[model samples]
Target: MKKYLKNYIWVILFVIFSIGSYFIGFKPGLVIYSNFNEFFLEMISFIPFLFIIIGLFDVWVPKEALEKHIGKESGVKGIFLVILLAMLQAGPLYGAFPVAYILCKKGASVRNIFIYLGAFSSMKLPMLGIEIGYLGIKFTVLRTLIALPLFILVGYMMEKIVGSNFKVEEVKT
Candidate 1:
């Protein structure tokens, strides 16, 4: 029942938004027509693969095993790992949530979750080539490098302030 309701939610949202959009009577024709394929393509391309990777990670990387790498003690090493992990990822925020969800479930620390999301949000190395092509290597690298420390800091602060409810609760010794 919960699962059915969850799936129904999106359909409901789509209907509401479509109806609202029509009544809003704005010039959405071009915006919707021009972008629908791109949006659909992105969803099809990213979401399934993201789910598979997350499922695989959950299966392969046991909670006890992950403690060595991403636990609280890992600190800066964990931050770097998160950055690399984020850099390797592609697609939208939804693409990354499955991994984040599993990480939280697997005893990954709250601070690390913040770092992981921050790192993932900040480091788009997969798109660096496009960024460089459109802008320049120096520009892309400089921006990312500058943002790196800030992202880590933000992650740290967020973990401290938001507390750990954002992730699965684990007993702290």
Candidate 2:
């Protein structure tokens, strides 16, 4: 019971706050609760599909292949591949973390993981189309040009900080 409470403290607090706010007629709290509910439902609907894909990737893709392609020595080709993967992904930024974890476990370089995350946040192809449609080609292109190099630099700096020997530990369910 104690362990369960510790693990779910935030969720418990959120429920309490939502209910308390409802009784007190707090408009902002109600709005926050509503938003949380919507987001939670969205995640619930999407996460299973994401996990299925991740599982398939884990089982089907050889670890040796991943290491060969994106490990510490992979360099520019790895960066480009990571960027392409990020761009092809369609979902919220939060969805990228699980994939990153899998990548890390499968032997992706820390730099490449960071690059994948950075590119996913800024350069998703679906979002690019929307941005171009609404914000014009020039703005979108300029943003992409600026973002790509910055993210790459950030990834490099993060790799230096984290060191090339980093490895992710597996979490037991």
Per-prediction TM-score: 0.56, 0.59
Q: Write the per-residue lDDT of candidate 1 for residues 128-173, one digit (tens) a residue.
A: 5445655677998898889878887887788889886666544433
Scored by CA lDDT, what does every candidate get?
0.67, 0.82
Looking at model 2, residue 107 earns an lDDT score of 79
lDDT, model 1, position 173: 33
Residue 4 displacement in candidate 1 (angstroms): 27
Clashes of 1: 0
lDDT of model 1 at position 169: 41
Candidate closest to the true structure, highest lDDT = 2
How badly does each model clash, as a count of residue pairs? 0, 0
